[model samples]
Target: MTTTYDPTHPRYDNEGDMRDELLRVYDLCHGCRLCFNLCPSFPSLFEAIDAHDGDVEALSVAEQDKVVDECYQCKLCYVKCPYVPPHEWELDFPRLMLRNTAVRRKHDGLRAKLTDQALGRTDLVGTLSTMVAPLANAVTQTPGSLPRRVMEKVTGIAAERMLPPYARQRFSTWFKKRVTPTLTRRQGSVTVFPTCLVEYQNP
Candidate 1:
C-alpha cells in the first residue's frame, strides 16, 4: 500500500489502492492505539477491530465507512501520531479518510449527489439563506424539529447537530455599508473574504 495523502498521486482515489491503504493504516492504528482518547473515530475503529478479533481485514467496507463517518476532520490524530510524515510509517489518517469520502461520494444516490453539489457552492447557499435570514433562522433554530429532521434525511447532516446561526445581515454586506464607507482615514486597507462558513454559520 502506498501511504500517500497527495490527491495528485496517481493512486490517491483508486478504490483498490485505498482499500489496501486503509487496511495498512488500520492495522498500524490498532496496534499503537495512541489516539484512543482523541475522538469518536478511534473508539469506533478500536471497537470494530476488537469485534473482529484484532483482524483489521475483517472490517467490512460499511464498518470502515462508519469509522470514517465518526471523524469530523478534527485532525487531532495527526498531532498525536508518532508515525506522520517525518517517520517512515507515513500515516495520515485524516487525509486518507478525505480520499475515502471523495471516492465514495461519486457512488452516492441522486439526492446525496445533489446535496453535495449544493454544499460545495457555499457562497450561493449562504447568500440565499441570508437573504431570508428571519425565516431561515426560525426554521433551523432547533434540532430534532420536523424541518430539521427532514433536512437530515435530505442532506445527511445530523438533525441533532446545530451549526452556528447565520447573521441577519452578512458580514460582507455589513462591512460594505458600515465599515467601508466610514473608512475616511485608512492606515492599511484590508480585504474581507466571505465564504459560507463566515457569511452564514459564524458571521
Candidate 2:
C-alpha cells in the first residue's frame, strides 16, 4: 500500500481506527526490531509485545500509552528505517506516535489539554518568563521552594527538574549591539536562525 499522512483523514476521526493503525504498526516494528535501541519507545513496544508472546493485542491500553508517551518525536527511527515510504512496509514511527498524541489530546480532560497547549507554546512562555527572569529563575531552580512545588502541582512538571534559566537581555538585543568581524578577505554571507533556546534562555 502507498502510505501517506493526513492528520484530518477520516481514519483518525474514530479512536478505534487509530488504535487499529497503531497496533498494525506495532506488530510490524516488533517483527523488524531494527530501531530497538534508537529510542525508548521502540524498546518499550518490543518488551510489551514480547511479554505477551509477540501479540500486540495482548498489551493493555495503559501499556500502549506508555510506549507512545516514551516517543518524544526524535524521528531517529524514521531516519534509520529501511522500510519507509516506497517500501511495501511503510512505517513512519515518529509520525505514528504524533498521531497517537493528537488522539490523546483530543480525548484528554480540560486541564491536561490546556497543559499540552501551553507546553506547545514555548515562544510565548519564554517571552513571558524572560520578562521577570530573576524571579522565574529562582523559583524554577530552588528544588523545595513553595512556588516550585505549586508550579509542579499545577503544571505536572517535576519540582526537581533543572529548567534552563532565562536571560535578562534577549539574544536579538545582544546580537544587534555586538560588533561584527571585519573580514579582510572575500567571504560568503552567513545567516543565523537563533532558536528559542538562543533567543531567550541561553542568550
Candidate 3:
C-alpha cells in the first residue's frame, strides 16, 4: 500500500513494485485531471487510459514509459494537486518521476541511459565525480575517447553528447570554507533559490 519515492526503500528498484505504484498514482491523476495541462505527460497518460476505456491497469509498459519520459520534474503538477501528502493519497508527482528514473537505472542497467541516471542523482554523482574531476571531465567532454566509447555502449548515452563537468567542490562546501569578504559600505543581503539545474552547473 506504500507508494514510496525514496530510492532507499526496499521496493524502490523492484520492477513489479514500481509498476504497481505507477498504476496507483496514475489512477489518481486520471480521476482528477486537474493538472492535465501542466505537462505533456498528463495528456498522453489520459489519452492512453481513455483508449483503454478508463482502465489504468490496462496501460502497457511502453505506455507507462511514454508518460514517465515526458516528465521533466518541473513539479507544477505536485503544487496543483489537491490530493498531495496529508490527504492520505500521498501523491507526489515529481518524486514519482524521480523514482521511475532511479528504478530504471538500477533495474534496466545497460538499457538505462547515463543521462537519466546522472540527472536524477545530481548530488551523489557530482560529489563522486568531483573526486576524480579531471578524469571524469576528460571522459565526458571528449566524445571520441575510448572511455567515452565504452561509456556509451555501457550506459546507452551517445558518445557525441557532452555531459557538463563536476566542480572541484560543491558550491555550499566552498561557500562555507571561503574567506568572508569585508564590505566597505552597507549592503543588503539576498538569497538565491536556484533550481536543481544549478547543482551541476557550479562555479
Candidate 4:
C-alpha cells in the first residue's frame, strides 16, 4: 500500500476530526512500544497513558501537550516504525505530533501563540540576527545577560540553555562568494539548499 498525504484535507481544518485521529493514533502507539527509544515524545506519551491505566482518554489535555512538546520533529520514529502508513496500522507518529501541536497552538494563549510564531519564522530571525551578528553573538555568550534573562522570563526558554550563535555572514552570502566559476561548462548544474540549522546556527 502507498501512503498519501493531503495538506488541504478537511481533517486538517476540523479540530474535532484531528482530535479523533490523534486519539486513534495515540491508542495504536500505546499498544506498540517499538518506538519507545526513538524519541522523547514516545516515552512521555507512554508514561502518561500508563499512569492512567493504559487509558489514553484518561490523560488530560495538558498531559497530551507534554507529549507533543517533547517531539522536536526528529523524524527518527518515522524511520523506525514498522506500522508507518501503507501498513494496516497507518501510524505516522511525527505527523501526529505535528498535528497535535497545530491544534494545541490554535487554542494556546496569546503569549504561547506569539512565541511559537516567532520560533517558526527561522528565516526572518536568521536574517535579522545576522545583520547584527557581533552583538547577537556577544549577547548569547554573556552569562546571565540581561537580554537572555528577559528572553527566559518572557518565552520560558531556560536561562542556562546555550543559544546558537549567529554567523558573521549569512550562509547564502558566504556560499555565493566562495563559489568559483568553472573555466569549462559543467555537464550538470547543482543547487544547494541549506536547512535553518546549517544556514544560521552552524554556518
Give each model's whole-structure lDDT. Answer: 0.84, 0.82, 0.82, 0.78
Score candidate 4 by lDDT: 0.78
Over 1-203, each residue of candidate 3 has an lDDT whose tens digit, in order, gives 45887778887778887789899999999999999899899999999999999999999999998899999789999899999988898999888888877777666654465656755686687778877888788778897788988887776778888777767666666666889789999899878664444544464
Off by over 4 Å in 4: 1-24, 32-40, 72-99, 179-190
Give every collision pair in model 1: none
Q: Write one digit per residue (lDDT tens) for candidate 1, span 86-127.
A: 788899999989988987876689778877866678778788
- Candidate 3 vs. true structure, TM-score: 0.59
Q: Is candidate 2 or candidate 3 better by lDDT?
A: 2
TM match of model 4 to true structure: 0.68
Q: Report the C-alpha displacement of residue 12, candidate 1, in angstroms.
A: 1.7
How accurate locally is residue 85 in candidate 2, as Cα lDDT from 0 to 100? Answer: 80
**Which structure is stronger by TM-score: 1 or 3?**
1
Winner by lDDT:
1
What lDDT is reached at residue 178 by model 2? 99
Reference-based TM-score of each model: 0.67, 0.79, 0.59, 0.68
